[model samples]
Target: MKIGVDYVKVRRSERLIDMTQYLLDHPHDLIPLTFFAARYGSAKSSISEDLAIVKKTFKERGTGLLETIPGAAGGVVFTPSITDEEAKEYIESLAERLSEEDRLLPGGYVYLSDMLGQPDLLRKVGRIIAAQYLDKKVDAVMTVATKGVPIAQAVSYYLNAPFVIVRRDSKITEGSTVSVNYVSGSSERIEKMELSKRSLKRGSRVLIVDDFMKGGGTVNGMKSLIEEFEAELVGITVFAESKFKGERAIDDYNSLLFVQDVDTSTKTITVVPGNCFDKE
Candidate 1:
């Protein structure tokens, strides 16, 4: 290949590193081969070869995936995913931490803010959740305000979709809002939730995420909001669920960990793997 006189020739190793970094930074986005070719002052064929190597490495390491498109308008996109073994190990570690007696809070609630606030853990969570919906063509992620926000944001980061937050109180900044009333699953008291009318469009496919669920009243309320917008609820996932609760308001959902038992008197808790690993 003739090196362009106007541009400095870049080494193959440097090119590979740059290309891989670019793809990882812009996951789920398509970039034309011509763009990379021009940026590196190399031929499109060379760029394609580099991408193939990156794809192989990604698959071999169980990091993520690279999808190539053919033809003149084609390029590549990265999709974040986690291997089953790694995901299982991570969940088992999380459950162990959750079982600690010190994490127990008043009213039988478990404090998980420390784990949720960790960026590394949240990124792993994003990868696992995103992997589940890789083929679902999800349009947006929705969650109730506060605890669910981080999980929704993490999942949306990997999914390359925008996230919508439903608030417990109406905000004037949201302009016109749609509100719904449902019984709080944990407290068994009637509660209200609201979402902005402009935040979501009709017929959008949404994935609901939350940090915890007891009775699933909050998720059920979000479901009603989805109905009000004429959008579809693709799926629901929670970081954890309390097993002590009665029948959930929503049956179709996934949890990463289940709080199987908790005893305030003895300050002990038991946790088990959720239904995500159940053999179908």
Candidate 2:
């Protein structure tokens, strides 16, 4: 391995420096301990110790912050203090990056399917949304078909709860499915799905989750599904929210990605914890 005086400066071990750097660059990004241990050719136990040291030293210095979330979706998140100037600079940088020509898909779309698969990114985004609903007693998560499923899954996993899939159409095993009509992003009529009188219990609190909200139609559909179960709408969480002109259907919600671009080839995406500052 390429070693430098800076690398050797870690007062703990060789891995601590690497670990700190990993967390620094990927603030609020949650990752499994095994993955980092494997990446650095260290043991999970060894890495855990190293992380503890790193977390302690960094937190003491106010240069690092670590959060340990328990459960299947739980992991460590390292976040550094971000200044308002830095936030604006990053957002502008993202806008410029997304304005490139090569990134655009057909039909004036910027496909972000690949980014959703990233574990670290998903975890951080999920934590920010889940933070809003902490101690709210949310039962099951609900989301529309296809792309939104992953976002919903991430939130549900972090919340340590099962996510109810709302399909576009009914399947054989669904058994008396609940259907709701809604308008698509392109102004086309569409219907979303939910299992008929399934897992959601009465008066159960629910947090609506989705990947993107163009017009909040799908969000509303999911809200209506929650109503079908006689559940209380705790809050809505989204990975991204378009600031298009219209009233939002849901009141309390969280979003990581806020801006929407009408013309972009690269479809540069900007993300932040929009809900992290809100009152729970």
CA lDDT of every candidate = 0.90, 0.67
After superposing candidate 2 on the true structure, give the runs of residues whose Cα lies further than 4 Å from its correct spot.
1-101, 188-192, 264-280
Model 2: per-residue Cα lDDT over 1-280, one tens digit each: 4466556445346577677777766655678887786787767777777878887887676453587776777679765533334434543444454445565677655566776787865665565556556546667787777888788887776566677778877788878776766666447577655655676778888887887777777888888778778888888877666665666556567665554555544455443434434443
For candidate 1, list the clashing residue pairs, or say none.
none
Q: Model 1 lDDT vs. the true structure?
A: 0.90
Would you estimate the TM-scores of all the predictions?
0.94, 0.61
lDDT string, candidate 1, 80-163, tens digits: 788999989999998998999999998877889888899999999898888888788889999998999999999999998999
Alpha carbon lDDT at 177, candidate 1: 95
